[model samples]
Target: MQIFGITSQELFGQLLLGLINGSFYAVLSLGLAVIFGLLNIINFSHGALYMLGAFLALLGLNHLGMNYWVALLVAPAVVGVLGVLVERLMLRHLYKLDHLYGLLLTFGLALVAEGSMRYFFGISGETYPVPEALQGGADLGFMFMPLYRGWVVVASLTVCFGTWYLIERTPLGATLRAATERPQLVQALGINVPVLVTATYAVGVALAGFAGVLAAPVVQVNPLMGSNLIIVVFAVVVIGGMGSILGSIVTGIALGIVEGLTKVIYPEASGVVIFVIMIVVLLVRPAGLFGKQA
Candidate 1:
């Protein structure tokens, strides 16, 4: 019944939870990787955008009477549009400037977004109810799994890989890659690199938004939600090697499982486990597991 000082049930449950956490980690880091690869900007506002996505879903549910399913689609679209605007109005100008400028500007925007939300919402979390359709759990041999959480894992994996395939296997993705590698050549070939840049940013933020919506039912929707998770995601991005789509996905899930195991074995270390792994990765391979050294 017990495995390594913990029950099988407990282990399975924690592992399931870890997978769910990893789902979010993978999506968020994937977005970060994508944006960094193309735009060469570290998007500090990504967390804010994620927070906004959750709030947008909440708004849709509370004000517009939209269901969770609808919010899943609508929330990302709204936030994606916001991302495009941010790129056009703010980020685009900073592209030619130092990377530090992008970081600072986005960080400032994050502060403003969080501050505004706190002013209105008072930093209290708003609950988004799990949809009626997904309000149950499945009884596995070892443990019971929440339907929504299981859905999160499946949905996250599907989206993560689908994005990977699109970017890695398709012509659009090929064009996007070419644009980043050789913008002048892409432009000469009449690919409209600027438009592609904007669209890539939009897609990246949309991924963040999608993750947020998936998370809202599982966690309280709050201004600080994105802030809390972004750090871990960044670590995942670093450990997996930034801009490596598959690397991000695999590392995120693996770290999540490791975090879960730590919680079971040593609860106190759970909080810092991912960062600890990150430090170790930094020391061992400065370029990360899948990263190439410049």
Candidate 2:
């Protein structure tokens, strides 16, 4: 199978890998975008939270012999519960202050979480094993893609789009949006606006947790993982304008593949390409590819 003399197999292979990477980015950025949109907080701890998810999954595996499927169920719930506790105890206080304070607080929280993991797990990274069930490749005529990797791509996209649809096209989503814009008005209607806000934050963090669990098999689970990839995610959110969920999802996946393709060509430039794209996008359309300025 060849197209334009470029083997369809090779092209599709890279594209598939790119889409997998993009799915993680999309979901991760979606979490960031949600926090930014409603809480007006940058969530500097997002990367830390993500690392925590993977670490927690590793713990489930090592101590309890839990496999990927069980870890997938357990890890996110634990992390999400932690998120809700943080919201009730920490973020709730910052909601009335300057956004920078929230950023600083979350930054400190990230440091605490990452440092604790390093203390226990050591600074060295840990590996996550693939289950026997997802250990083979699927031949699709044009490409032979790994089952685990393909699942990661599909699952991430499903979660990302599902969240978007829930938020953008549902009655509950309408109320959530309204609450973000005018909390007092929504509260006056007898809705627990603060509780709703906290729930949204927890949901966003849980999505991050899910990403971490899914990512364990594909990437090394490490204390430093968050710091390693967070800046790129932040750039993705910025480039997508953080004003639109769809923008974040699309831009994240597109940029990931763009980076992957760059790796195939000029490997040296791959590291900085995302930031370069960010700068270009900001200069041309500060609102981002699918965003609208407030």
Candidate 3:
């Protein structure tokens, strides 16, 4: 059957691909939202950290004979620890300075991280093999769905909603939110706000790291991997609202589907469609679709 001059298969295929891409966007943007909402810092190094996570997985697999499952857990933990160090040794010092300072520092850090990886690994990309269990596809009547892609969507959604619930539903989340709005009050209440801030940053970047591992098999594991997607991910966060968890999740998936459909309808316009939507959203709702008015 044909609809709008496109075969049903082609349409569904693009939708599936878009959903896979959207999964990554949702996870990455959720991390960005968490950091910005809590730390009030623009972590330009997020992409670099994501790259590092994939690299760690690659290294672990090659050097230590680790499997995909091991790397899935280890890579994120390692990156989260590194995040803790960065938060304590560097980011904390600049908390009182302008937000621009944090941005510049992180941007520089991203460059250094990417450059170092490029130096060691070279610009050419490497591929991480899919886990044996997820190597096949399933016939879903409308389309053949790759098991790994389905897993990506499921995993990303779980993490996104889990994080959202943690922040928006739980007492710990309540404290975290309270700390952002009234750090002094939260601190006076006997909470170690600095430690909490550091932990929050670690968790945020760890999400990036987790996404990296998920993506290692889907895309080339190159130093520039994170750099390539960071801008779009940032756009996702902005459109979702700067610090709105639900906003990020919804916008990421919606834009991903929009981009996918555009590729089918007009290949040339697909690349710019999200940015165009972003511009329109900015003009209509300067705070973003879900962002609060300042």
- How does each model score on TM-score? 0.98, 0.94, 0.98
Cα shift from native, residue 246, model 2 (Å): 0.9
Ranking by TM-score: 3, 1, 2
Task: List model 1 lDDT by residue over 129-221, tens digit each.
Answer: 999999989998889989999999999999999999999999999999999788999999978888899999999999999998999998999
| Top candidate by lDDT | 3
For model 3, name the residue pairs that clash.
none
Summarize candidate 3's per-residue lDDT along 79-154 as a digit string, tens digits. 9999999999999999889999999999999999999999999999999999999999999988889999999999
Lowest lDDT block of 10, candidate 3: 1-10
Q: Please, what is the whole-model Cα lDDT of each candidate in the order they appear?
A: 0.91, 0.87, 0.93
Candidate ranking under lDDT, highest first, comes to 3, 1, 2
Candidate 1 off by > 4 Å = none
TM-score of 2: 0.94
lDDT of 2 at 157: 88
